[model samples]
Target: MSRTIDERIVEMRFDNRQFEQNVQTSLSTLDKLKRGLDLDNAAKSLDGLGDAAKRCDMSVLGKSVETVQAKFSAFQVVAMTTLSNITNSAVNTGKRLVSALTIDPIKTGFQEYETQIGAVQTILANTQHEGTNLQQVNRALDELNTYADKTIYNFTEMTRNIGTFTAAGVNLRTSVDSIKGIANLAAISGSTSQQASTAMYQLSQALAAGKVSLMDWNSVVNAGMGGKVFQDALVRTSELLGTGAQNAINMYGSFRESLTRGEWLTTEVLTETLKQFAGAYSEADLIQQGFSEAQARDIAQMAKTAEDAATKVKTFTQLWDTLKESAQSGWTTTWEILVGDFEEAKEVLTEVSDAIGGVISETSQARNELLSGGLSSGWKQLLDQGIADEGGFIESIQEVARESGDAFDKLVADSESFSDALKQGLTDGVVSSETLTQAVHNLREKMTGMSQEERKAAGYTAEMIEQIEALDKGLQNGSVSMEEFTEKILRPSGRENLIQAVWNAAKGLVSVITPIKDAFREIFPPATADQLYSLTE
Candidate 1:
């Protein structure tokens, strides 16, 4: 045993030679295993232990190489079993980690929240272009939406119509009333908010252009039903002229006013007009009278068949009468009671809307408080079983993961520090080298005897336990010396000793690295070694 300092250098050189030979042989065996060789046999066999046994001369050691190979082969089996268990555990844990991250509840909730805000922004942008204030529009929408929710109306439809009504110069109160009226119309007439808005807008244009008298407009409004019949007449006349509504309104000037005075809109008057156009004049004559060819053909064909004309007339008359009855009865009395009047409804709605808005805001603030770290740990625990926002669940999970990672790191750091201290004790003569070597050997044997579960409970990861076993084996088998272990494994940062080691190692390995550096200084640079080792500390 090379216990004296004089024999230490020779032992180190011999260990280095053996370690290099073992590493080369192991790498070659692993390469063969990677290429689809029989992995179990290759891992267990000692035939791949390299030519060290032959070159070192087995007679001198007094043991045949096969006997040593058997022992090494058993260690390999134990090490491989430990590694396989660790890999399986890591894969299962990784699957759980991925599952937790992929379906993050808070992330999904925030995405939905952002989508709702985006839709609101789009509505606001569209409403703002029509000279309505965004705040006013949003407030009206909330109030009308709440009101609709309490009634038979669809909240989404009413909310949409409120924005449209406000943009078209309707006050918030009238907008709500109009939404109610339109919703009722939709129920009775199956008209959508889009169609109602177009009809109302066309009526406004007709009023603005003096085509329909103010009296007619008020009659349409005070009836508390959408003017679907009146608007359809205008649309039909426009179609007859092969033109848009505005152009039709402009060209005819007082067409709606004339219709209101007579009954160009009533069933009797429309039938009379169609009868006169049916056969009293040619298609050319109707066209000369400003009717399109398609319109003349339709009129002439309708009048040609008495049954066709009568059926069409009765259908039109029944539709008009049904709408008239719906306008008079459907929700009109309820609308009058709820609103009292349009002007009064505005004041009432504004006050009620503001109150409801306050309640909504308070509810939202309370929810935000619970999510924004305001709750106690006990409350948080209970709340975590349900929905949580980004500020709550994600933050909590991230903090726990960070703490677990930090704890694992500390465990590894403590084990490394303890090993380093043991090596340092031997160097300082606080313990004899024999005592340190025996201690390492005993630790390795104890660790190897434990099951994988027992090692895990003792805070030893697979990598840490594997390193301890391999280093002890190298020491006991004369494959690695204490000097190599100290220099490579411990890599001590004691300044003077580190500088000496670097200088000695550099002299042997990099003596001819640079001709200029060699000529300028035969010694390694202390400045470079200090700079390089500073990072370790």
Candidate 2:
């Protein structure tokens, strides 16, 4: 409807004041949000409390943020409609003002012009959604985007402000940067351009350093090496080696089937090797088989020693086993010995068998000494006598030597099946479950002690915030901004008002409950998590 001069003046003044107040209110909400977020979290003492709040959690804060976004979008639509009307009004008013030329009509029209400017600014900055201009009739959508940006920024500067402003991320690049994901996560935005840039840089640095984002690594087996001992073990066991004693050791270990390699074997090597091999057979098995690694390097060496022994006891054992089997069967020993394809081996076995009586005497003596608690002295005596026998007792002595040598051959042969094979299996396991499990346990332990707020903040790095601040400043200075101050209100700082509202809501909840908790912590001084959560009826 056409209005009188008085009516239009009143309308223009009222709308201008209201717009200014809305700007102030938006700034106030942002300020309160910052204050609430920064509140000291020391009073929060719940174990596993940190899990209560997550940056990615789309709960109360997130839902509220979405509501704000929807509202802002609606506000954009409303502004567009208003701008279309103002543009039409501006044309006719300009003509009428020019025609009247009287101070009254000119003054009324000037106020109208100012109101149109404000309307135009809102439409230009915020008149977009789904490829449709909210101000459907308005022709200056681009200009409206620019104007909205400048207006919001000017308002931001006027009431609420983040650290020095700047342009970041894509202001230097063409096309509007997409932040739909961010909007979905946060209900309100207080992140300045510089803060967003700082976040980007932090994210970049984390990537460059080969860190998986928190989201990416949240489910990782070892939290990307954050576990204490597990982390150290991985580094120690998996890191590439350079030339040094450590490197040499690692190489030797690897060659010897250890996680790390070593250049040379030592006494420790021999002991560990022996212990590991001993694991495969019971001591009873060793006694029955008469195997020992003490006398030979290989099965061949042990076999040779057994054959050369004075009494030939060990070789005779193989013969007795053969004889016992042959005797127990319906076979004739002579016939088998003469006609069997294994005859040469059987003939040699008979010769060793002839010496068993002599070897048994020496063997009995060694056993007697050991049973009598003189094992060391007896063993030393046996070694001292060696392979030499000066008397006619050489037959018996030789038998003992051959028995000892056979024991050594069997022990050496088992090494392949036991020690070397076992060690090799462990070294080849590419990732250790034991280490990863320990890391997960440790990370959970460390994080569980913090409050929910702290944990939420933990995922957010201040470095990212600094980068965002720098970006905001860049935008302000037009260093990297495609006129961000005029076009980028759907940015980190766009929903400051909404962010503040959420914070205030959280704070208000805190204010109501703060006194009791503070009093309780003071009086009881909770010594345990259970005590902190204790409530009264």
As a TM-score, model 1 comes out at: 0.19
lDDT of 2 at 272: 21
For residues 414-468, could you state the per-residue lDDT of candidate 2 as single tens digits? 5554223212322443212232223223333334455767746665334433443
Q: Write model 1 residue lDDT over 1-537, tens digit each, in one string.
A: 546875888888999999999999999988987777776677656555555455666574566566688889998999999999999999988875554334432343233223323434545565555565646654655554444433334344444444444444444545454454434343344443345454444443442343445454554455443355435434565555444555535556754544444333432222223223224456687678767788767545533442232122244433443333223222333343555333355578889999999999999978865653332322232223221222322233233334434442333245554344434443454433344355556565666688989877866666655776676677679875555334332343344365788899998767666786766676665467778789788
TM-score for candidate 2, please give it: 0.10
What is candidate 2's CA lDDT for residue 354?
67
Model 2: weakest 10-residue lDDT segment is 157-166
Task: List where candidate 2 sits over 4 angstroms from the true fold.
Answer: 1-133, 136-432, 460-537
Against the true structure, whose lDDT is highest?
1
Candidate that scores best on TM-score: 1
- Count: clashes, candidate 1: 0
- Model 1 — which ten-residue stretch has the worst lDDT? 381-390
